[model samples]
Target: MNNSFGLTHIVQFFLFVALQVLLMDNLVLYSTGFCFIYVAFLLYLPLTINRVWLLILGFIVGFTVDIFYDTMGIHAAASVLLAFLRPHVLNLLTPRDGYDSSDAVNIHVMGTRWFLTYAFTLILFHHTAVFFLETINSQTFLYTLVKVLISTLFTGIVVIIMQLLFFSPKRERIDYR
Candidate 1:
């Protein structure tokens, strides 16, 4: 974030937003699970990205979705919360050897356990904010929590599958004389 946001991220932003608003928006399961796959864009940003930039990017991602979904900034609020809390979660889950500043948070680099844990934790919080803020009522608290959990699980699984299918792990090339 010290430099300008790169072309790669700009393209990815559009792709994620389009994918979410166009496809994932309607991909609800049993009306209890929603797939907010757009968060993968924010979650995959470089480890050392500036916190302020992260928040701005998060809001932009969510606001773009809001424009399509016609929801008044609820996604923006939840995304801001995700960006705000991401660093703390990363710190808590940091590997003993630590992360390379340039590393992206993905299953390809972080390994499955780490990625799953990180994805689920953030997605749980993100979905909770999205669903609960969308409807704040004691009458439906239990149902909302169920939705949050289901959506979190669903989103996390899809995010991981995305990385696995789309991103190739780096392979060491052996040169023989």
Candidate 2:
């Protein structure tokens, strides 16, 4: 990545984290699904990013959110898991045409179906890890399950909307070769 790319990501990192802590965190739906839009940073990372760097970035983003939320390590842990699993998730969803390492993973590039599946899978993984760890002591598995599902749906919807509105891709075809 060039210096500008790195700087752009740095700016985005702070922007997303601030949004998560300042705004999204305050918007609670039915006292359940909390929006963790910060994960969008991790989700939209360049496909060629080093795994180690990705993990570290995920940790930084999550830990930043955790500090503000006063829930030490919960966000960090889930974020690390998301980062660790990202490559695998993308690999599993790779289109028959294949992926270009230079391209960003957004709805505009991957189409709506692929983007939805990719985003939902990662969001579900993230929310599951977060809710389960935070509610591990609780006896109600069903309640935890419901929270994870609702939160995943809410987060996924917001992510898709954001991509459609602001990050929509340019019109161009990606060659598998």
**Which candidate's lDDT is highest?**
2
Runs of candidate 2 with Cα error greater than 4 angstroms are 171-177
* Tens-place lDDT digits, model 1, residues 8-122: 6888899999899889988999999999999999887877878999999999998988899888999999999999999999999999998875566768778889888888999
Clashing pairs in 2: none
Worst 10 residues of 2 by lDDT: 168-177
Among these predicted structures, which one has the highest TM-score? 2
Report the error of model 1 at residue 137, Å.
Answer: 0.8
Models 1 onward score TM values of 0.91, 0.93
lDDT of each: 0.86, 0.88
| Residue 78 shift from truth in candidate 2, angstroms | 0.0
- What's the CA error at residue 166 for candidate 2, in Å? 0.8
Evaluated against the true structure, the overall lDDT of model 2 is 0.88
